[model samples]
Target: MEVRELLAQTHKLPNVPDIVRELIQQLNNPNADYGDIADKVIKDQTLSLKILRLVNSAHFGLSRKVSSINEAVVMLGMTQLKTMVIASGIAGSVKEVDGLDLKKFWSDSFRVAALAKWYAEKSTGVDPDTAFTVGLIHNIGRLLLHITKPKLAEAIQTLVDQSDCSRSDAEMERLNFTTPEAGQALLALWQFPENLGDTVRYHRQPLSAEAPSPLCATLHIACYINAAIGKQQPLEEVIAMFPSAEAELAGLPANIAAVSEEAMQIESGLDGLI
Candidate 1:
């Protein structure tokens, strides 16, 4: 099936609650009113409670309860919000597919997102929030593949079972393209921001990205790091792929350092989130 067909099948894919999606979009808009944005967030009772809890969570470095969405936003900022959104989306959408290994998939995804946030902070002026969102959404093509063609998903697994190749390599060799491209295409169609779509498209090959992006180099390196430790790739080789990846990872600045620390504090704070 095609991309549109895949999305159509996602009626079973889980809704993110219109208010949640709206809050993210408004957060992105320069002229968006904060009061209206908070109002939208408060529309979803569960999400609002979750946001408040997250604000009070150690991840935000806050000592008091965040009574409102606006204060939560101020305390946690957009990066953590994206994490909550994605984590919640995942919890709401997951299915029990026979023979599919979802745990390994998300462990690697979250780990890479963590590393990518660090790299983005080190590499550019890109908000660590944007970096985290890009990293979390980068693998969406896999999600699409399962939704579009279940047989292809099983087939891809078989290929991986028999080969040592990366998923991007497997997809490109077999399909004449990669998941990142297809994913970026779909998110663009869904009206996600251009830079976000670009990040998903070029995450694996930052050097040859289609659009100019500050997040590309970092995402590439972050993914490499996860592939290095989380999967089969050797650490030395993955670090070697990018000139100073090892050094950058070793030298993460204060805020990024704090983020990493928070990641360790809760193995499952925003459980059920993307």
Candidate 2:
């Protein structure tokens, strides 16, 4: 089925919480009343608890425990607080997917998020928090597919396993669309920022965009590094094989060895997030 068809089966897809929708809107609003937003988030005890647990966990490395949403905003800054709230809301919305390894999926996503944040910090004029948030949700389409079309999703996975083709190729062959495309569609349906949808849409082919986006390029690099590190490739090998073209598109420095190490270190400390 196409992306529109996939999305039409609304019952099969996880719903974005109202608070998360509001937070997404706030992303582009510099005058957003964060205090009011924090209050609204706090009212959702479950989500707020998850945010607090994560912030106080070893992931954030905050010196003191954050006892409330307001405290978390003050300690982590508005951008980080919004990121946590959005992540917590989205993750909490999906209870399970029958054929998916939820733990591994979230772990890898978080790693990419951390790495994207690192790269965005190094790139000129990129919002590190936006990069992190996008990285975390970049693969959400895979989860949606597993939930809505388990058999087809399994078929695609089997095809990838039995062939030399990449997952995106397998997805296109079977579903006529890639996970990034589905993810972009979902983000649009959720009324997230257009730029976020654009980034997710072109992350797999950043250079293909009319105007290459630094955030998209950053995510591409982050995903590449995450896969390399997952394979236990040495730091030297990863550096040598870095996506230099993408880096140039992102306006990052040529020597990314130190950046990679720092990002991986940060990801290593975020086990609690997954």
User: RMSD per prediction, one decimal?
Assistant: 5.1, 1.9
For each candidate, give its TM-score against the true structure: 0.72, 0.92
Against the true structure, whose lDDT is highest?
A: 2
Which residues of candidate 1, in runs, are more than 4 Å off?
1-14, 23-28, 52-83, 90-99, 173-176, 232-238, 241-269, 272-274
Instruction: Tell me how many clashing residue pairs each candidate has.
Output: 8, 0
Clashes of 2: 0
lDDT of 2 by residue, 1-274 (tens): 6888789889888887898888777765679888888888889898887778888987577898889888888898877777777777777678788899887888788788888988888988678878888988889888888888899999999999999999989999999999888988998888888888889888988999988899999999999989987888887777777788999888888776556666555563444544
lDDT, candidate 1, 1-274, per-residue tens: 3445555665544344554455445545667565564566677677677667666766556777779776766777754654676555543456544455676666666666676666656654656666666676678777667666678777777887799987777776666667787788767756777777887887766656545455766676566656555455543454345435333433444344223323332233443333
